[model samples]
Target: MDIKAYIESGIIESYVLGLATPQEADELQRLSQTYPEIAAAVAGGEQWLRETADHYALPAPEELKTQLLARLEHEFQPEKQAPDLRYYRRDLFKYAAAVLLLLLTVSGLLNVYLYNNYRNASRDFVRLQSGIDMMAADNKAFQAKLAVLEQDLRFITAPGTIKVPLAGVSGREDYFATLYWNTQTKNVYLTANHLPAPAPGKQYQLWAIVDGKPVSAGLLNPNCTDLCMVTPVQQAQAFAITLEKTGGNPTPTSDQMVVLGKVKA
Candidate 1:
């Protein structure tokens, strides 16, 4: 059988309503088994009938359908309803477009919010990273200072650590100085800051007074703000400094005295 031509005749639709002659029903079954196209045509006809009934958008009253079916069965008649077909496809399209636009708006907003959050997160991460680096640098400096203090503590506990007191003279009201030294270790630490800076071409020389005779140790120009360091010599009793020639004087010229200290260290 030519399936397309058979469908054009509407026999497939008539067969779904159980109105086909006995011979025609048998022919339909045989054609369905012989060609897949015939089976598809039959299915398509049934679906079309259902969709056509639904297109009206309303069901017949239940009692009306029952009564109609009973009359068709009793009279052995073929009946088809011609009901009103009103379409709202345009309205449905408008509703669908509105829903699609709402979805798009929500999606775009979510994307922008997430982008802003990612940018803020990146900024916060960079700030935390910089703070961590600064903390690491501080920790390194603290560790270095700790090591120097450990060395100082060890030397202070050793046998003879002389604590010498160096007092200020003229030009200093009540400012004082001190020196901690270990002659055996030849290490000295000078602490004095209240003394004013010396005039240009003049400086303060440290003298290790031994048996009323003074020996040159080192010089402080008064410009040194940091604690001055001195080399400890053996048999030193006192400390003094006098303004001498720029390189320093081999002997004290007495009148150029800036400061003198009797070492009771």
Candidate 2:
């Protein structure tokens, strides 16, 4: 396999971001074990992400350590009986080391996942914050928008949500996106996760093939959040996105199709 091409496909980003499905994750893990280049890429990505997050890390409160130690002391206290000093000391050190190691491992893993989520949320917040600050925004309006996003997240993470990876077409190998389709609800949501900003007066449009005809799913807004709701279809055999004139076209211009993916059976 082409290691460089695999790395450039954005699967690594999706995996690091916790967006890849179980199958995809399993495949990546297998590849990482089989290929030195993949293993290096994954490790490098994790290290770079950790270093980037360190700049934004906040210092813990002074009292926090004291409280943690106090709790640990209480938990490891001897029962209502005389204790062996040397044995107690040895066990105490062992347990303490184990606890510390566990905490560090969990914290590192949590930080990676949380950092990706925080980055996405921060982008959305920054985009709207300026307008909110200028308008002295209505709390209800803000909450409503937030509620919608929370709902979308629930749908995306819900069990049975099918993740379809869309790859860039000819001449646009770097462009990619994902489709989260809920079979039960027949709801389709599109995320322009890695696609570059379209040129002026051009926009990306999504299409779903149903009954041998192409149906416009929706026109993607470049400025929209990572997840955007597209028109729901009862059924689709495939999905494709194309760059079209602003406001989109009645039908996709074949020559302009940027990415496409077939729906799994």
Local accuracy of candidate 1 as per-residue lDDT tens digits, 1-265: 5668887898998898789999999999898889898899899988987897789678658899788878788676335433211236666778999999999999999999999999999999999999999999999999987876776666666667777777766765365566667767877666664555567887767788899999888776455554456666676788766767677888877876666678775
How close is every model to the real structure, measured as TM-score? 0.55, 0.44
- Candidate 2 residue spans exceeding 4 A from truth: 1-149
- Alpha-carbon deviation at 151 in model 2, angstroms: 2.2
lDDT: worst 10-residue window of model 2: 74-83
Q: Which residues of candidate 1, in runs, are more than 4 Å off? A: 1-101, 170-173, 200-202, 221-227, 243-249
Model 2 lDDT tens row, 95-169: 999999999999999999999999999999998888777666667777888998899889988976888889998
Candidate 2 overall lDDT versus native: 0.87
Q: Name the lDDT of candidate 1.
A: 0.76
